[model samples]
Target: MSSPIRLYMSMSLDGYIAGPDDRPGQQLGRAGGRLFNWLDGRKSGGPSGQVYREAPATGTVISGWRTFKLAGRRQGDHHDGVPILVLTHYGDEGGDGDVPPGHARFVTDVEDCARQARAAAGDRPVMVQGAGAVRAVLRAGQIDEMEIHLIPVLLADGRRLFDHLGPDHIELDLVRRLEVRDVTHLRYRVRRPGEAA
Candidate 1:
């Protein structure tokens, strides 16, 4: 096993990951896409811009179906070194456009997702992209790290930093913190089941 997995997400200061409308491909914003303006990606940068200015070299990217669809993906897109993985339950297959030319895999089982993510990750890190999906990974104790970009806005209600999970606790050690372009980056170790205190 290659050291579990990690979650990297952009969250509002109030902890809502996405606004309440919550439809595939429409979870964030209109033409401007202000939700992800902090992250150095297409919404924030032009086609030939710096998407990796603050991002680290991770090998795998995992996200929920909603996050995957809403966050427009370009085939062969690479940030630092991470490819993308979209999670789904076997029976919940909705229709989609042609598969992009990147390494996007649809895995039904969480364990299978973990295994595949680890394989894709190799020795590098995994950037867990959204809230509900990261919740699943954290609940299964499959995550190793979490990178959250703390934005300043606060939405009253929306998709949250965590979704419906059974009784659980997410206590992590603060690995690093930095404020860039007014956004705070928080890194944490997803404390394993029987790991050190």
Candidate 2:
């Protein structure tokens, strides 16, 4: 069986992932940097801090075009060695080459991208980043788990995490919750109707 797909992201207390007017240079938008203040001067080797120290053994990463372009333009291969599958209709664009050699590829279809990511992941889980891609996967019922790092900030005018989820209601079961400084980590298992609890 293929590995499951997991979506991970950090959002403000008010549920905004990125601030207003997000651009290439300012992907997180104005005042967005404040959301990551919990990691400043954070020491390693502590029990509560282990989650930050342990690198996720992700086999593949999936991201939306805007996220991929911004990250790749600013810092090449933001996910390090993990391969990334960028979902976009403009696959012929030139920015795709900014990623590490053979580390990233562009795909037009979301389902095909997920399938390829899962195959590439093998035993490990496929990591999906960015709010746009997360919403797409969630609407498709392709995500198995979601880990949200809730920061203690309120970006009232930024892009919401769940803005365009269509008319359907997606259900999630809370699996774990941990508090590290001002940030709260929430792990949820996606559940569909008629599925075993």
TM per candidate: 0.76, 0.87
Clash pairs, candidate 2, are none
Worst 10 residues of 1 by lDDT: 46-55
**Residues 1-197, model 2: lDDT tens digits:** 67889887878989988889888779889988777665663565542365454336788888887787777432435446677887776664534544333567777778888899998888988888878888888887889998887988889988788888999777789998878677887889999867776
Query: Best candidate per lDDT, number?
Result: 2
Candidate 1, residues 53-124, lDDT tens digits: the string is 434567787777666666664343556436666776632342364444466666667777788888887887
Instruction: Give all candidate RMSDs, comma-separated.
Output: 4.8, 2.6
Residue 45 of model 2, lDDT score: 56
Highest TM-score among the candidates is held by which one? 2
**Predicted structure 2, TM vs. truth:** 0.87
Cα-based lDDT at residue 124, candidate 1: 76
Judged by whole-model lDDT over C-alpha atoms, candidate 2 comes out at: 0.77
